[model samples]
Target: QQQVKQSPQSLIVQKGGISIINCAYENTAFDYFPWYQQFPGKGPALLIAIRPDVSEKKEGRFTISFNKSAKQFSLHIMDSQPGDSATYFCAAITSGGSYIPTFGRGTSLIVHP
Candidate 1:
């Protein structure tokens, strides 16, 4: 079984600061990297993702930077706000494999106004 390790069990950031969460995976077969965000009483939602082909990807205030050689990826939230406060999880999935995602433990983000 592949293992995904995420850093920083929790995080606190200012309303306009940048929040970064990192994750590392053991499987080289993993092809997709997606970051999921979940708020209270809600299922995880895809925030952003990046493939090994791309080094970086950006969507709105969220960005995913991937390092294939390092087998790691990170999520960068720019201009983070209190509304963005949620538990973030990193996941990896392989289309040819089971297609089941291996997720990180999750990081709770608290943005202070």
Candidate 2:
């Protein structure tokens, strides 16, 4: 079973707005974070990630922010668009164990243009 919990099962954002998704992991052993975005009829792709050493990581308009002490992390989409609509999953990978990813329930994001 995955130890991560995500919130806001679904989200609706206006075009050019900001879309945010949050997740919390229970295992302190987890050190790697990966955020996946999946489109219909497609597999999830690595969207972005934040390392435990950094509080935040930003790439283009996408950003990943985390609180190592809180064991919480989040994904942020800036200037959201209709094309950005998809199901987002937050995952954590253990540093010493199997190195396998344990995913959260996922959040569905709908961006209206």
Candidate 3:
């Protein structure tokens, strides 16, 4: 079975509001968790990431919270803007192994002005 699952397949947020996406993984082997953001007609880019050792990581308006015991993680976008609208994916990879990442289904976010 796939190790990762994501929820709220799609989301809509008013401008200046916050957007949240959640993901959970079943494999204990996964040590690296990353979130990717993609715009139309472009490849996905790394947004934020957290290691099993860290409880949370934040940069700019993006934040990632990780729960090692629960094997779950979440992404929060603060002050979302229309330009921030994009498809987001949460992925897990095993450290010191084949670095191939298992990606979640993806969350489509729309920020309306």
Write down the lDDT of every candidate, Cα atoms only.
0.94, 0.94, 0.95
Best first by TM-score, ranked? 3, 1, 2
Ranking 1 against 3 by lDDT, winner? 3
Query: How many Å off is the CA of 86 in candidate 2?
Result: 0.4
Clashing pairs in 1: none
Model 3 pairs in collision? none
Q: How many residue pairs clash in each candidate?
A: 0, 0, 0
Q: Which TM-score value belongs to model 1?
A: 0.96
Q: Best candidate, lDDT-wise?
A: 3
lDDT of 3 by residue, 44-111 (tens): 99998899898999999999999989889999999999999999999999989988999999999999
Q: What is the C-alpha RMSD of each candidate to the true structure, in Å?
A: 1.1, 1.0, 0.7
- Per-residue CA lDDT of model 2 for 1-113, tens digit only, reads 56999988999999999999999999999989999999999999999876799999999989999999999999999999999999999999986789999999999999999
Estimate the overall C-alpha local distance difference test score of candidate 3.
Answer: 0.95
Task: Indicate the residue-level lDDT of 28 in model 2.
Answer: 91
lDDT digits (tens) for residues 57-95 of candidate 1: 999999999999999999999999999999999999997
- Arranged by lDDT, best first: 3, 1, 2
Measured against the true structure, the TM-scores of the candidates, in listed sequence, are 0.96, 0.96, 0.97
Better of 2 and 3 by TM-score: 3
